[model samples]
Target: MATMNRQHHLRGVLLASVACILWGISGVAASSLFMLNPHITALWLTQVRMISAGMILLVFGQFAGVKPFAIWRQRATALRVVSYGLLGLVPVQLCYFEAVKFGNAPIATIIQYLGPFIISIYFLLFKHVTPTRPEALGMIMAFFGTLLIVTHGHLNSLAISPVVLFWGGLSAIGVATNTLLPRPLLPKFGAVSVTGWGLLVAGICLNVFGPVWQDHVTLTGAELALILVIIILGTVIPFLMFAHALGYILPTTASLLDAFEPLAATVFSVAFLNVQLTNYDLFGGMLIILAVMALSLNGRKMINFLRSFRTE
Candidate 1:
């Protein structure tokens, strides 16, 4: 049993790592889309992402013997799906776009990473579950590292526009809620089914509110092709991997691993966008990587340490 648990954890970690890698690449992809227009890019990407991911997952759910519509009959399940769609999927993308509009992609990505720390606080205060010492340290390290990256080591330049900061903070909250909301439903309904339904509902919401269809969208062949790639590789595949991994991992663990997305974005930017990598970026990335490693390998020890300190 011990060996089996270890193997399971290893697999989950691998899956989460891959998800972060794909998410990191998405920054590069989104930057490419900026060549067209930011609003159009945001609208189309959200529409394509939600719709394509929804359809793919729905097909998968059906193959797995889960009917997507059947979930709607259960009001609670339907509500949960809607909550995931509206509160989870929509806000993350929208706020991210808004943040990027006011700030650079790297800065926006770093601010959005505030999600894990938000989750940590939520768990610590509301759930009354003190994180272990290692986890607490990891959280602190990750937070500072992300801040350093966002502020570009200057720390004084951290004063972003108010609107951008607000949206970025909201994006973090959205991620925290999304990560926490699925726990109760995962056991009753499979993660795939829940994710599929939520995505479908969210896709519909995006379409309804999105400006792409409103403008009677037309796309260049290149743009259309890129959109399809974003939908398939960027949105659908990553979310499926996420759902699968979430089934085998703790939410906190999953969120901690997600910190790698920004680091991955940094690498992708350096490679494709001609973004310079300074010593600060390297140092910050190393700290975030170490923090994630500590959380993954020694979470329980960290949690215990925090608990003891709190009690003392």
Candidate 2:
């Protein structure tokens, strides 16, 4: 039993790592689309990604003899799907695009990763559960680490717009909400089905809001190819992998592993974009990695200890 559990945990970690790696590649992929207008690029990429990913998952679900829409008739299930699709998936992507437009990609990535610590706050306020000491310490370290990366190790250099920050924060909240909202429905409908539906709904919403019928739209061969690759490898595959992993791991544990996205992005940028890596970047990256490790390993124990001490 012990060996089985350990194997499961290792598999979950590997799947989560793959998801982060794909997500990291997205940054480098997206940078290539910058020759076109960012808004158009973002809108087109969003549509292609969600639509393609959703369709592929739906097909895969069918092949696996799984009914992806088994719970669509249930009112609660419908509500959960819409809520997750709109408030979680749609807003996170839109807000992230906006953040990248107003700020740097590295900065936006770092800010979005603040989702996990923000989730700890959400549980504390709503669930009336506080984090363990180690978890809290991890969160503190991550917060500073994020700040270090975003400010480029110069706190005085901070000049982000309030609107950008607000949207970025909203994106972070969307991530937290997504992390928590799928638990009950995931078991009933299956993670792949749920994620597929969410992506489909979110894609429709994005189209409704930013209708692609505008005359200014133009797609070059290179852009179209990039968009296709983004849809397949970046969005579809990673999301499926994430859903599969989520089935085997706790939500908080999954979220902690997502902290690797920024680290992966940093590495991707350094390699593909030929971005210079400094000592500060290395230090901040190490802090973020350690913080995630600490949180994943000792979060629950630390929380219990804190609760017991408080009660005593």
Candidate 3:
């Protein structure tokens, strides 16, 4: 029993780590696509990615007996699913891709880390929940990290363009919506079902705006191969692997392992893309990642502290 448990634990860790690493590498891959081909717009890439991954997930869900389309049987659930796709999935991918296009993968991914702090703010404002000291401190750290990333300690000069900053901020909001908007539906519909539908719906909406077939960019064989990498290795595979790993490990453990994502992006950006990072970028990235780790590892303690604050 003990050996089996240990094996499961190890498997979970490996799966989570690999998934996150692949996700991080995918960001760099997207960056590469942009650098190699200026004609390839983020809008076009996002549409292709969402449609391709969305279709695959739905098909896989069918084979796995998930009854993927059953969520559409009810009008309310269907509406909610559509909302998730439009407001959650679409913006998250679109804004993040834009951020990566304007900025490097490392900065984009690190900035998206602000999503959790945004979630905390949502809870505080809407649910009237008070944050623990650690949670509050994490938010503060995230703020300074973002400040450094954009301003580099000097507010007068912008280290990155305003476009990147805008997209990064939107990406964080998208992340918050992506995380929170699907919660009520997940219990009844399952993550795969909700996400699959959400992606498909978002894909369709994006296509309506700019159809993938109409994308005028000509692609080389290598560029096409990288596109496949983004669709398969970066998006679908990691998503599935992370979901599966949850069966064997705690969610908190998986969340902590998510730290590898930004790390991988930073390494790959520097190594392959020849992107240079300043001290501000490095320090800001560290603080953001540390804030995520602190929040995840000390979630229960943070909750306890919140309760104590309420009592006081």
Candidate with the greatest lDDT versus the true structure: 3
- Candidate lDDT (C-alpha), each: 0.70, 0.71, 0.87
* Clash statistics: count for each candidate: 7, 2, 0
Q: Lowest summed-lDDT stretch of 10 residues in model 3?
A: 303-312
Per-residue alpha-carbon lDDT of candidate 3 for residues 153-207, written as tens digits (9 for 90 to 100): 9999999999998998898899888976777777677888888889888988987
TM-scores, each model vs. reference: 0.80, 0.83, 0.94
List runs of model 2 lying over 4 Å from the truth: 1-12, 36-39, 150-164, 246-259, 276-282, 299-312
| Model 2 residue 248 CA deviation in Å | 6.1
lDDT of 2: 0.71
Lowest-sum lDDT 10-residue window in model 2? 303-312
List model 1 lDDT by residue over 1-312, tens digit each: 999998998888889889877876766666666665544556566766777678888898888887666777888777877898788877777677666555545656766766756766876787677777887898889777766665766767854466777877888787777766665666667777777767667767776665446655567786676666667776778777877787778865886787678877777777777766666656766776677667666656435544454343
Q: Write the per-residue lDDT of candidate 2 for residues 65-169, one digit (tens) a residue.
A: 789878688898899888888877876676775665555455566667667667678768866776888888988898777666556667777545666677677
Best-first order by lDDT:
3, 2, 1
TM-score for candidate 1: 0.80
